[model samples]
Target: MDKSNHVEINGDRFVHRLKELTDAEKQCLESQNMRIIPKLKAAKLEKDAKRHWDIFYKRNETKFFRDRHWTTREFQELINFDPDERIFYLELGCGVGNMIFPLVEEGFSNFYFYACDFSPRAVEFVKRNKLYDDNRMKAFCADLTTDDLFDSVTENSVDLASLIFVLSAIDPTHWSHVATVAYKALKPGGMLLFRDYGRYDMAQLRFKAGHKISDNFYMRQDGTRSYYFTEEELLKLFMETGFEIIMNTYVQRRTVNFKEGIDVPRIFVQGKYRKPLEGKSISTCEG
Candidate 1:
């Protein structure tokens, strides 16, 4: 861990908690700067969101995003199992195999991976990756916010389901449905790995006026949208949807401009939520 990114919560190094900052940093947070929804077009754009993401992939061709190399570092349990142990892994919004490929290539190959995304192009890229193997990994297109993940896998077959930076891309109003699907796809005692944009993050604070779709929700210039989540909201959502939070903490880092000698802190909330040994039925939980 870099010294600048080091933060301890409750005497634990990786536990998630809101950060306390100096007066200057606090002033820089700018949590009160939500913009007005300039045009109702944002609503229509959000409704037709699949098109925007499809176009985003077409134009960028996977160049805009970097492969995530931090999953194993942050979630040691994913790679700590015996080499022969059988694991069923599902990653919602698996994008371009950033989390999946690294775990498999770097010694977590004893698992069956089911990765899904809404964009067909993104799914194709994952399939075309040289590291992707059909026998061990399956990348498909599905929208869990409105569809069940089990449509591509057997019920309760997954050991771990990850939603890395994916949930916030969805419309906030539909998150309950997404949670229900994730819970349904996992076996009893299965875990859901979550890491997403935290409230008052630098990215959230950088949004311009007229792009706001809702409080802490905004449509970017490219038509894709995001929601900044607070820890309280995540806790309530997980507990109500039959999850018990195991490791909950925030990751914060300060980036400096050496020439100007200015620093800015970036915050992201990460958590591990476990399904109960006796799980809740979708009917009762979603109700």
Candidate 2:
């Protein structure tokens, strides 16, 4: 077995709380910002973000991402419902069916999944999967930043929306639009589950000078971009978008390679927010 790829969440080497960066790590981050990507290059990357992701899938296919077996563990909401209750679940960036197919195999027959991705190649991969059933899942390609998710998903009809590792890949300028789209597609009381990279994670610290694209955002070696978020800013973004925060916090995990004797910290921001019921009145004073 390959212990080299082992990743343990809240593992023995790391605490679950927010990680304070060491002086060296802080200095490395400062150095990363010294030579940012040129304006012309940054603009072109933003304009052709979809193309890069399409190429990513064209090369890696479904093999790049492992099936997400941790969804139920992290989000008990998936199993909290009655076995017979129909869940109109939407996965905002369902990459190659990595997150949805596992649920299907787990016998979530009641969830009718609507999965979308920015890359057409990724969506096609989802559709071609052996577990994909027309009755259980509907996979398509849509740029959540600009394309209307409601074109395929009915407005105010979704029961749950998961944006796992999705928002970070988008430019900060369009984040609000994506949030608004998710809110519109969800029922008034529907929940949105989000998990994304957090500030000063190992990956962010490793980037060398010249990749920075605005504050806390950078381009990866493959041309795909990622933005690290602070929990406060992320929560504020959703709250301002009309979601009432249920929970928001940073999660620290460790990736360990015993064979190679390596252990590194990973930081992520996880949140759950709910859309307030329409026309619900608030009382000024408590009883």
Candidate 3:
């Protein structure tokens, strides 16, 4: 006899189990885990990293993601722009103007946008978009993790920098360097807004043991890698890089999968960190 999937001890509709796992299920789960060839993993990760991203852009082009329509709505910091005042904005790992186009459409006219992506094709997509304007939005292609971003953008420049779902794509060790660039690139008192995968997120939990690149890093079959972060970890990263925290919060949403009789929880870490206005001068780093 099969047991019930839900319990009603308190007259509440609650799910007791995700599903029953058989021995076959366990075997299949194990098979789905990531398998790294220990000796070649590092080399493979290095060589294929850029290529995989290139291929991803080539495959999906501009259709991969929807414009982030909720940006201004979700975070009110982006609003209250004055038409006469000029606000310089920089976006790292900007993908197809998802954040840019939306903010522009919302009439943040005073803000000039500088968007860069490692993938040339992705940059091209941004430049070619219907919403793109040379006078307002500039698109460039460069590897931010190892590139001198100042060459493309001005030094001590932008009033705001955004890293939306971008950091997870990078190697964890390189984040300090990433922060350095954003720090030096921003005007004193400028803010960096961040959002990325959070620790124990469903996406992280779904990965099998073999796919675990490190404690919280993993690679997908598509050759893309992601790192899930804890609130503490993220705080430390930005704090060490000379940013003062404004707001750090985790957002959780539960989506019910009626077909599978399961509830999938998605967790994301969002933050606003600012550089001190009256402090030391920003240091420059070479690529």
Candidate 4:
């Protein structure tokens, strides 16, 4: 069973629980399929993706996203490693060190962290954090959809890699490239952890028609884009990139606030994949 608990942020208690979506929620999502952003605008958004993310970080700094403390609990591989064992852990699209900092604070000294983001501002934020140690971690800017990640992280060298809420930020057409790059970066038997917005997720359903860039993909008012995923499609993406699926499923949660009289159901897809211990080298690029 998935964990459900009451979390208090800024003194207001929010209850989160596992719950299926109600019919009304399903209807709202269906409504989003009627329209999408115009082609020229969508193309421009894709081309200026990095600039938008740069502005996002410049405006929000490190306040928008909370540090991720749930990863160690959700992914046992993170905590299973020996404290002194040397493991190369790579975080693709690591925004502001939200995920890596928590692990460092929790005493994961065994990890040699390599983190990258599309926005240079985001990487600067990570580097400026007090906990960032050059000897233990390398924070850089790289677009996973291209060969930039390979320039910093050698092929077949990473022991663990994570794509937490990262893939959705990328355009679906280049998803194959992201997977291929990750596949090439990991050592045989290395693991990749993934979590991202799921189809019919609250955020996806909330998008007005004009915001839709394509099916399950949308642009926010700030110009940043998101692509919601289904468990089947996400699994197929990594599998076709030559990864062995360990687990893949949807995580459903309901956020409820009594004072605000608000209740929203959220959905996310999470998965774990591993490179085969013995196999031919995974090929680069698909179509």
On TM-score, the candidate that comes out on top is: 2
Provide the lowest-lDDT 10-residue window in model 1.
Answer: 278-287
Question: What's the CA error at residue 210 for candidate 1, in Å?
Answer: 1.1
Tell me the spans in candidate 3 whose CA falls farther than 4 Å from its real position: 1-39, 254-263, 280-287
State TM-scores per candidate.
Answer: 0.85, 0.91, 0.81, 0.87
Give me candidate 4's TM-score against the actual structure. Answer: 0.87
Q: Provide the overall lDDT of each model, using Cα atoms, as 2-decimal numbers.
A: 0.78, 0.84, 0.76, 0.85
- lDDT of each residue in 1-287, candidate 4, tens digit only: 22454443343233333335678877776777777688999999999999999999999999999899889877898887777779999999999999999999998888999999999999999999999999999999899889988889999999999999999988999999999998899999899998888777778878876898887789999999999887779768988988988867776656788999999866777788888888555532211
User: Which pairs in model 3 have colliding backbones?
Assistant: 34-210, 34-211
Worst 10 residues of 2 by lDDT: 7-16
Cα lDDT for residue 162, model 1?
A: 94
**Compared with the true structure, what per-residue lDDT tens digits does model 3 show for residues 1-287?**
01454333222222322333467645645554546435368558756887888889899888888788867755566775566889999999998888899888878888899999988888888988898999988898767687568788877888899999999988887899898888888988888888888766677667765665665678777778898877678778888898887766555556577999988766677788888787655432210
**What would the per-residue lDDT of candidate 2 be over residues 77-101, giving only the tens digit for each residue?**
8889998898999999998988889
